[model samples]
Target chain A: MKIEGVVFKAGEVPKTLFKIVSGTVRETRNKTYHDLGHGDYVALLEYLLEEPIQENIVATEETEIIEVSLEDEYLNIIKRIIELRKVIFESSIDLEDIVLDDFNFEKVDIDKYLEQVESLLTLSAGDLPDDRDEALRVIESLDDDKIITKVNLVRSFIEKFPEEEEGARLLIETAAKVYIVLNDRYVAKSLLKKLLLHYSDIPKFCYEAIKTLEGIYRDEGNIIWRRYNKIAKILEVKLRGND
Target chain B: METIEFEPGQEIIKEGEEAQYIYMLKSGKIKVQLGLYEFVISDNNPEVFGLEALVGEKYTETCTTVENSKLICCNSSEFMEIYGKTEVSKKALESFMRRTAKVLGWI
Candidate 1:
């Protein structure tokens, strides 16, 4: 493909998938431009979902692409990888430093860094009661910047301490609160809902989870108010002490 | 809050349709069709579908009855409120949805 040549125009039904072999392609979605070079591709999510291929793909330079088929054999492999992430996520088993992007698994230093993360989970909140900010600073600020690192660390903590309810609760609460600023709302919600039930017996845990839920509801226009109300009622009755 | 019965081949949901409920299969089997790309056998008790409704998105695939079946369906929010109450139930339901998302295409 040569410069300005359209590969896949926006709003077209994807009949075939394409992968870049060399040179560059420009992808414009919703007016945002992304440059794709060798080994770069476009619209896999839209294609896999069978939704309209709503992005314009044009060559930025002399480019070459091989048509990729969405055949069963190909789809099954994609399916297996998605299933693997879900299972790995649920287990909190660090796939070294794996994070999902472009269907690529980014492995990290598992044996060493994960051990540091695991030890961080065991730190006592009571040990730093006076310096909440200082203590949390030790666990990564969870600032909007570097949020991915925070999410992975929190996920590892949740996975590592399923049997240790306190450690898990702390990580879950962090996800619902700190991660709300990041792009992991749904993933955070999953952990929040799970922890809300798993540690509902502890008044403190219930309080934290409810606060997070309330914040999310507020941010999302409170459309799920009834659901929030119902959860609040159940937690209220189950709450042991200190409202 | 309602139990709907599906005579075999009845469509409970269609691909790209706006999602209204999250369904937990009460009995019998259902075929989850992913735009002719895949078909899933969801026969397990409490086999849940339309879970992407939780993300407030449209249906990702079609769900039709494969055998005479019953489904206990709840609005997305209501389903979350109820399922968010127990460890085992919440975990099992999440697991089921995660598996289904892979095979169900749009989810």
Candidate 2:
């Protein structure tokens, strides 16, 4: 059927999905525009979840769409995953904008920034935020205790950088040290492993990772200790040759 | 093709270094480090690394071996003399295009 404007209002459950046979529709949520063109699915995620539609799907131009029912469970799952990824990825982009905006030399409210970092922790996979330089600046300016208090969030923040910059390395190393004190040795071990992966060429960080990782493994059972022991020994030999 | 072997954790190429050879993975795993992104090239892959040498550009990324590995190495003139007319040149160009597309998020 031909449609024009406000096809699906926000908060209204659009029980049916539409295949855009022609023209375009704009999906807006929280002031962001997600334009959909030919062959795009409208309200598919909302329909699949049977939840209130969170976005206003409006026909930006007089558009043609066919109401379609999704019956294949496998395809529905794939669609759900795609929609979820879009949500998470877009959230990262939005957070990057907010970080860039608030990141400045002026004194920052630590609690406000901590809330932002907590949200960033939820993003497991996506492009590194373009505002990472400012983000790192903000992270670096924080007190060690503040970072350690939220070490898991700090680790996730640093891991977003592909290469370990000086600031990032320092932050992750600090996180590794204090996470164990908080009884979160798992985060410590993972950060230590990340240090090894990115800084293998640098003996200083390599030795630190090997030392900390060994200490963490030592607290485990004999089998786990022995398993980590072999790798640590190999890295130690490599570090010695570089010295 | 002249073959060179790199031990695991060895730095085969450094970013900003002069591009010397087009490298083809012969065996084992190699990591290509670009900015904040990394991808692996393994044995039996038809792609080549260090294409910057062909254009006389500096190596854009550092390449390192993740395991003891062998690579087919060819300098610019050598590459032209060897894979110049063969299907390998086309494949190499295609690989470069695919990687460029990925970096641009076009695919």
Candidate 3:
């Protein structure tokens, strides 16, 4: 059967091995995570070691995975792969100077630390509500640059309080910045539409959303025109004369 | 291809509509209903639906808005043709089917 999947996310390490009968594999690794997609096999080392596995394997998109067991034949393949992997990892490591040093434990700065804690509490207590209000105020203020900062602040606040309507609104405004940034049009369009539905009465949000919708259509390439037109019709109805 | 926006409680694609397009959720949340089962796919987990239609098949379920939503629509035939040409797309489709089958205990 055919398979379709994307590397939605990765865990600390890979825990599965997939032998590609056919197709290609793409592996992406970033500071926070590592992703493996399609034809890549996972966990060859663990299978060879017969050790407890420590990584996660999740399909990036809808995927077809044939689970391979550690049978004798598969074990031989795993052994070869493990040796190759060891060689690769070892060759990549660089030797560095090591200094032998004695460890000393320092006395804790109890009072100073307490004072710092109090200072942090005071700062957060004062700044949180102010930041939240400023985020809302900036949305109302409609200054484009302020709107962007408000969006970031709103997202930060939402990370702490996802149910906040004000924060959600700020996210919508931030989403609109897609038109200005030219990155991830789909995400921007989605955010604008969400704002109109959730914050329809917010005044000017609907207008801004419609304007962004138009921008999406104008900017989309011809190959995507058919999809753009359908979205445009909806925006036309939603924005009406607001745009 | 067309785009559709739905408010919470709105139905974007009915259960039995001739699946003509592949849907990409650009934002918000959508709920897919199949008989008694329901799952919500949102911006954080945007979904591509009506893919079966790409194989010239009927839609397996109805997709509606769980919250306000934005959807990008692409002609099923066009999308299938484009997707068919890509090795990644084929692998993704196969992986998805196998996983789904495993989850449902069908394989």
Candidate 4:
């Protein structure tokens, strides 16, 4: 006879070790018991413990069965599988805990790297007085990963030369983009307003601001639509005056 | 600064009244109803309503106390002043509006 499946309830006793000579067999906990196919074996743990089984075993489908008394080789295999399962379960829990902790950073020399970059930019400029071309080159050379980093650098450069309108405008545009990337819509809106205040004649900046406002409205309609409506009203008033 | 208590079925904020204050629930339950939609809150979940009206909307979802409830109310003018200055508050408002528009198919 062949064993097909095994089942066990919490408090019930188990006996009789059955080997699957053919087909599939399944052994599941009573609470989650469903069905098992053919060639399934059961009772290795019960035989090892030399105690009554704590679950009911049944054939899920048409099957045959043979009961084998306790044996040594079968007990070793079951013990090995249980030990491996325990390690796998514990490692999975440890991995999840580690991921939740957010503990992944490798220290590197950011200051040194910045110094090297600044030196490269200075050397590339030769004897030319720091002009817009040089400033543009420096801005272009900056890594575009985080808008904040680029904005901060440009801001520091602007602070050194307060009267540099071109540098200030460029920095403001970069900062606005950074705010957008960071999802800081209010800051982006405020920055755009400030940009317009300084350079109202720049149609490109106005168009950019309008586009940014459109995105902000799309992302956060309830918060941005009122502001959009106000801006739109102002734009309309200006257009009507031109006519 | 005073704690206002309301019994069950009391209207905390009507639909069309000028939104003069924002209420933060300190205890008990409240329900926010917009047309056929309703959401209930109890315990420590602080619900912010009447904010839509603060931006000159002239109306807000109706709020009613679902049980014996305590609330701390802040005047809307003062709240708006502080809220407008806050970057986080602005972002939150934007996110809320954007999601609402998407749901309503106006975006």
Candidate 5:
């Protein structure tokens, strides 16, 4: 059915499951989390769960929804997911909006950010939110130049936060990943080599850096793997010598 | 193909998220599910999944790691290229026929 107006209210359940085929659906009742566009599900979960629809589904424009019915097997599966979602929400911080906002920092002060993260980690106990996950959430969030800028800050963060060493290591690893995802392997390679030499003293730092390098070069064939293997060999020897 | 590691409870694919890479389980088990139904532990099956967006398949299921897991992933185009190979195609066909023949009592 084509919808130019509201289909269901917050308290009512729809008779049939409808999937957005074209145009947008405004999901409001809580907060506007995000707009549901084409190929998005509507009322399927609520209907499957036999619960009242919790959101106001209104078409932002001319919207087409094809009525859909799942196989009994599939309907059973969706019911379990609704239950699982509640269980997950109870255990972890609601990460539903993690991908909604792209990590857009026009001015990123590395030190101030670390301080904020440190305080947050103190309260939450080691569950610091790393910006790398944000970058990975949306692959196009950071460009090559932006990632390079972040990598340069990794060393300084490590130096400043000896107590929060893991966060620093994560930053460096994330920076390298940005370059890898962008196919700027040269920058990623150089960053990994420098980490081996510069942060070789910290065992956890070296381990994470090497793993990030491995992940980045995982697509590269045997020859490149051998080259990366050589770097690891040297890093191990240097680290042992320092010990 | 590339190998990626995931921690327990990490959602590799969400219910409505665009399917990017087709994945093959290398090690460890993953729970694949939709709202109420969960597929059995995917330890025995070596089938590739997360291809619905590439093809025209509707996915209500989300796949999450059960433990520290390793998976090999390839883009749709890359997987198709390898899957389209004559040797791979022949082996797959033979495997299917063998299973069908056994079921039919013609083995």
Candidate 6:
């Protein structure tokens, strides 16, 4: 392909996928420019999402690209990698060091993460409510000044009805805020983690937890935020899968 | 808020320019450049960019399209007035954090 030649232009309905072999292609979307080099798939996201190609994909030099198939094993791996990247991107987590060959989905330990989430779900909540109704009454009877008492009652409610997702959600959502007010971030962070992990299906809670965690980690410093940000991205993707 | 479309290689915002709007990716991809640092923002997730507008500062970064793109542009002051407490602010904060992380070579 000659320089400035269009491989695919924005607004074109994607029909085929191409894999870059050599040279470079520049993808220009609106005013942004990104170079796609060897091994990068062209129109892959658009094709996969069934959306019109949204970028002007042009050869930036004498580029060689080969048409690829969805069934090709290597191409499938690429697809999976791109899909994973898409998930992380959607979750607002960018892994800048993702070398394709070094990437392994199995190594992500999603199962282990899932296992931890499951363990949390089944862990004994210190004491079960005498009954659901009693837990409800206590949960409903909160005074604005008694932050500690509110935390305890919230914790008790969760312990009392770990299985009650809807009821538990209401209290769990507010629990983190209260914990923050009490300056018990360790507990608050853990509670938010569990809340997000257990309630991955609920988008609102995931957003809240991620946002809160982002704030806490940001306050902690760049290095800590860097580490937690990756975990947050993973958690976000896990939640995306649930969605 | 209004949706705006751009062609490939179009400058959405320029460094040292007046920052009029905070932009969110409605669709497509954008390349952001700050000094020697650069990164791409795509619609894989709805991301708020051009955050300098939120602080009433001149744009410190340049944003351009790497492809045809659609963005939700909100007048900075208006956005602050209406969406200060909304998820948009959270997304903006997250974007700011990510940029800081990039500056620190942590992203």
* TM-score against truth, every candidate: 0.29, 0.33, 0.29, 0.29, 0.28, 0.31
Which interface RMSD values do the candidates have, in the order shown? 14.0, 16.1, 18.7, 28.2, 18.7, 15.4
Candidate 1 docking quality: incorrect, acceptable, medium or high: incorrect
lDDT measured at residue B23 in model 1 versus the true structure, 0 to 100: 83
Of all native A–B interface contacts, model 2 reproduces a fraction of 0.00
DockQ scores of all models, one per candidate: 0.03, 0.02, 0.02, 0.02, 0.03, 0.01
Candidate 1, lDDT over the whole model:
0.55
Model 1 chain B: worst 10 consecutive residues (lDDT sum)? B97-106
Please give the range of 10 consecutive residues that has the lowest summed lDDT in model 3 chain A: A97-106
Residue A206 of model 5, lDDT score: 64
**Candidate 4: where are CA atoms >4 Å away?**
A1-130, A157-190, A193-204, A236-243, B1-107
What is candidate 1's DockQ? 0.03
lDDT of 3 by residue, A160-213 (tens): 555566654565557766447647565465555555555555545555555555
lDDT of 1 by residue, B13-96 (tens): 875677788887888888776522345555564567775565555665678888998888888667756774454234433444
Name the runs in model 2 displaced over 4 angstroms: A1-243
Q: What are the TM values for chain B, all candidates?
A: 0.76, 0.90, 0.74, 0.71, 0.69, 0.89
Candidate 3's C-alpha runs over 4 A off are A1-243, B85-107
What TM-score should be assigned to candidate 4?
Answer: 0.29
| Predicted candidate 6 versus true structure: per-residue lDDT over A118-181, tens digit per residue | 3554532234358787766665665545544444555566555667675446545555565566
Q: Name the best candidate (by TM-score).
A: 2
Give candidate 4's chain B TM-score.
Answer: 0.71
The CAPRI class of candidate 5 is incorrect
- Would you give me the overall lDDT of model 3? 0.48
